[model samples]
Target: MTALADQTRWLDATAQAALVRSGEVKASELVEAAIERIERLDPGLGAVTLRYFDQARSAAADGSNGPLAGVPFLVKDLLTDVRGQACTDANVALKAQARPADADSPLVARFRAAGLVLAGRTASSEFGTTPTAESAAWGATRNPWNTALSSGGSSGGSAAAVAAGMVPAAHGTDAAGSIRIPASCCGLVGLKPSRSGARTAVESVMDLIVPSVLTRSVRDTALFLDIARGDEGPAPADGYLAEPGKDPGRLRIGLLDTRIDGSPVHPDCAQAARSAARLLESLGHHVDPGFPAALGDSTLDQLFAAFWSAGMGDLLADVARRLGRDVTASDVEPLNWALGTLAADLSADDRQAASEGVAGFARSVVSWWDDRDLLLTPTQAEPPLPSGTLASDPAEPMAPLLRSTQFAPFTPFVNFTGQPAISLPLHTDTAGLPIGVQLVAAPGREDLLLRVAAQLEAAAPWGERRPGL
Candidate 1:
């Protein structure tokens, strides 16, 4: 590999930190390296939405005092508020409203305190209502694995940046599979912590939105979580970086190859799930092909849709009013427009029912995890699709793309249940695209999940495998 390629390609956050601490590499150097890669590759990929090079250099100079000192990373534009950088929700209506944040969002502050150099902001769908990364304001973020395919969204830009070797790791948020989907598409490790673990103290708009990180190795994810996790309570008996506890003692893993809503997984994806099962068995874990009792009901999907629509309505109303726009249906993407329309028709009773339904679903799902430590499933129903495949006019319908892509089925359950989940780049399709296998754990069990993930990573290291630049 070329020098830049060797340096930029998949150095886990831990490795990068060690290099920085050892004085082998300065934070500024890594930031400059990432900026150079972004400059060279992002033109064709369209992954980054904003650049903060000057600020990054300044931060890197002073960042050595923090835990993640000298490691460069990108924050997804959807939720993070970087001071003086544009926090546009990737919407044209919100473009001119970009203003310097008075303070970092709580999660952003934690990242900064960890000694991470903030390189820039990554792209996302407008309002983050869509699964693909194509935006009216920032254009499309193509998959780093395949320029013609999507990188996945609304954290697509972050995933693309990490997968393309622009950075060792980047911050991402997952309300409904945003982090994992893109990580799967680009062949990276993505972890969505339990809602509580990633909760932003300031942003209460969507409690379901869990902040996460996308990385090329499991250790990077675990280390990032160690730094990012809340320290409100007594420290764990052991730190998150503690080694895996001897093979998880033959896990009773529940494997669901089919979609949660009874939809069939793509043939390739099903095969991937089987492959993962074999791997688990090889590791001495008992894998049973069965659905969680909580997943038997389809009502959870409708309930989640109701909650999702409500969030979209709130965002549309707030952003449109703030921008002094008329807030017509045409101002948003098709999926968002449909959601907003549904929100308008929802009654107080409907809102109550949705909340109750979600709460009940959460309780039931948590109960399932109480029995089994891990839930294994396909990260997505199929492999990454081409750009514009999920795009539609704001006034158009949403059912086609929603069903065809099988979006949100497997992922939202964890978000709703406030459980930790991770997508591991374990399998690939016929076209050589990465297919991630997801592992979910009960609330506050990130340590266990990370250990299992690390074990898998050791067995099958995917970091060295990269798409041709």
Candidate 2:
């Protein structure tokens, strides 16, 4: 165990792939070690919701061929589907049905094409409706740094698994900040790529969601973007792996160290952003106290709620169709149940108006990037919250949903604007919990985010900072 740990436990996926390519280690050895690690560590973290160990073992027989070949991987139990796996999206009803996916989603197919061994599924909140990965179906995913704290959701399980060295990288989806928030909590690099060049994740009113992976290093994220994007859209064919190793060139970066409403930020969270701003300056980028003013407009919240609630209603409709019966309030988590109810009450015209309003706001906010290359902010409103901070009973079904606003105010707007953002784990709060500082790039500029993130990573060196778990 000690020798295997030394050989593979903390190596990033890129490093592991290099080993396989060099014939220094077989892909099967990597998969077996990852399986052992997950079995040893995941009980306390509640990260992986299902296991496909035998399948992964068989797949690894040829996983030694190329880049990322046979690397152990887990997909978040969200929208991305792997053929033959049951995608519950962290809901009990679907888990009870245990229906397997007939075909892989495009992104999952790309993951396989990259030679990633599909290990299993990680937990997410029901329909990805919450930040904390606490669902009645799968329970909570704990932070590897501190068991009592949450690994931010709905990508908590993926983030947790990566941080705990269960896997070098794992798939996660970000609608708002699911990728970034959990990456912060678990001290991993999570990138939510721009929607334009990435595969379209169509939700109800807007295509707000983007799929990404939570990884321990920026190069892995970049390499993944190269594979995941796969000659799609305006992105360069294959420079993602090389982008991070080169200098990002001096550029203007705007800083917003407060909540979107101009309210005071948590002192620790603010300091994390401030420190990152200084770090950026030291690295040759111009940093100023500037951000898009549209971020503060209250109506943005209303529009986002409308879009998200309508998406929830759509989720229920799909679930109902799957079950061949109407999905009742009791079928889902409380907050999402309430959201679907509100969505059921909204008129189509209301959704249309909300979409148009959000588009206007996106134009206004994206225009800020006309002069600036990036916007810097705290990845989360505060450090990772305690285990039950967002939990609520059915009597107060909307409580968790309401609390989510205060918890992740700085991140969701990036989704609404359809831009690319990356969260880099740079600082720790008083509790020794990881605090990620976000860097946002204009839409279709995930390459910029990766370059800057790589620059920061080189300067700060977060790769060796593993949790004690």
Candidate 3:
């Protein structure tokens, strides 16, 4: 592979685009650099499961130009489909019967319009039901920070790819913290925009999943948001690029180190939040030790479990239809089988009750925003654990799943509330794994989150850090 430039592989998407736009580097050159990096590094990490290198090179050579012309990007393998690529959700059944998406999903279409060269698809959990990115089909995507550790799921492949310098930024989706969890585990910025302004082709289970990207810099995240927020125009026509680095005046920020479900947070994760709180205070924002009264209840967890199980059933049915065969327990992980089986037992009344419960919780949680401009919490309750921490067994599947996520009880609430939240890699633990801090904003107020995140990024810059390659 020809040398592109110093650290070309690590440059953010915005910088890569600038090089292409200025003709300092050809789009084809940038595309080759990414493909080269992926080829060189992906074997150790297993972040990318499918490659579209020839097509990407063809697109780059065509000069189909836009703001992000020639920037290399990967889509999470689950829901965000790219034309002529496998859209497996990391299930063996789907992987064995893979088919190219006939056309780009609307969000993928926007990425193409912005001039991103689609290079590959990243790994994700089966049906995106778990937080770790291991799959029977693609194996586990290892963290770049420490190879033995896992890259978090279901957006783990994208986060790991970006973290490993294979790409500047990659598409990720957040439903109950898929994007943010992996961002935390792999040390990248992951944003889940509010339902009002977020991009979507079709809503996933509970309509909680929001499409976004994982990047190394806040500016890259902002720019990608500008590109991904579809043409529907619920957001300002000017886009979100202007929000970062702009002064966000003193605002009310409620801090929650403790999870709402009364789950125990790792001390390192709690310290990460408290450290961010102090930093925000220094930056002139009022940080208080209070959260929504609606949080810390058992009902939210129960409701989420029910809704997720029902969604699993729906996903199984759809997968069966697509494969033209029944997806048996052996076709997927044990956890998925257990969840799908539970979903089969769900009555319509059970689904309705779960929906109602979530709606009620959302009302109470959103009401907290009336008293505060933002909510700050730990992105995950712990540092990146070794691979298979969230693995499942057919005999006792839920145990591992729930045990692995006790540190992340704060994220799912935001998903259910349909509010925007961003995970910033603001702190590190004793062993030096990245710990992300989540900042949540009211619905349709990503502008506020971006501004504050920019402030944090400046006050404690994380740009120079890199994983052990």
Best by lDDT: 2
Q: How much does candidate 1 score in TM-score? A: 0.93
Q: What would the per-residue lDDT of candidate 1 be over residues 1-469, giving only the tens digit for each residue? A: 3475466456777787788888887777777777788888889899888888888888877766765788888988886788667688887757756766777888888888878899889998877767778887789999988899999877899999988888889988888788888888899999988876432221223878888888888767767777776475332224665644435567889899987656688888778778888888888888997657877785666776677777777778887776776676556656777878888887888777777777777777678766787989988887888888777665456753475346546776777777889999998887788998899888888877887887787777777788888
TM value for model 3: 0.96
Model-by-model lDDT, in order? 0.78, 0.86, 0.85
The candidates, ranked best first by lDDT, are: 2, 3, 1
Query: Candidate 1's error at 108, in angstroms?
Result: 0.8
Query: What is the TM-score of each predicted model, taking all chains together?
Result: 0.93, 0.96, 0.96
* Ranking of all predicted structures according to TM-score, beginning with the best and ending with the worst: 2, 3, 1
Indicate the worst ten consecutive residues by lDDT in candidate 1.
Answer: 196-205
State in Å the error of residue 434, model 2: 0.5
lDDT for 315 (candidate 1): 78
Task: Report the error of model 1 at residue 218, Å.
Answer: 0.9
Say which prediction, candidate 1 or candidate 3, comes out ahead on lDDT.
3
